[model samples]
Target: MAPSRILMAAIVLVGLSGFADAPQRYVVSYSVSDHGVAQMRGQALISEEGDVSVQGSDQDGGHAFNATLNPTDDGLVLVTSLWRGATKLGEPTLAMERGGQAKAEFGSDQQRVVIEIAPAD
Candidate 1:
């Protein structure tokens, strides 16, 4: 093979390898419904390891929570105590991947949050 051709092939292989090594990214979003009333909506970026960095806002403009949802053996786990600027909420909520529903109780009200995490198209 020609030396120039071999070098060009090597460069192409290295560039492709860089793309292969890039981490997988997922765009996840969620909707919070309080007894069927929409309360908050947010989206997040999920890495290959299922580490979530979320940004959310209450639709009513009174409260907000920025929390991390870590993937677990069963599903995604959320600790309500880690919720910023909120109280009277449930703890240790699990968003099952197969079930597709994440719910928590705030006092007498129940908040059911739907989480969707699909591969980027």
Candidate 2:
């Protein structure tokens, strides 16, 4: 599939809206894909408090990544720690916003897309 087509396919699946008073839960999922082959896949549930817990894996095996999304002066700050077993890989921080949809690409030509899907109330 073409890059655009693949991107469109990976668009976030949003659910129905809920009551205004309740805190919303968002299901965020993404895959690092090259030519339709998923090199790594991850999914996370982001609470209203901005806590993010993600589990993902590649061909070698699985790993866990944890990050805290806190409100910042710009938008939001995501501090990520990647782990394989007990070994800590690296920490990459990104400042971004939570909105409708967004897309990003890695250095290896792998496409990463983020979709925020809220649960029905």
TM-score of each candidate? 0.53, 0.48
lDDT string, candidate 2, 27-58, tens digits: 54444455657655676766445777677665
- What is each predicted model's overall lDDT from 0 to 1? 0.53, 0.53
Error (Å) of candidate 1 at residue 42 is: 1.6
Q: Where is model 2 more than 4 Å wrong at Cα?
A: 1-24, 34-36, 56-59, 83-92, 98-102, 110-121
* Model 1, span 54-106: residue lDDT tens: 44454433444334456677755543332424552333444545324445433
Q: After superposing candidate 1, which stretches have Cα over 4 Å from the reference?
A: 50-52, 56-84, 88-109
Worst-scoring 10-residue span by lDDT in model 1 = 81-90
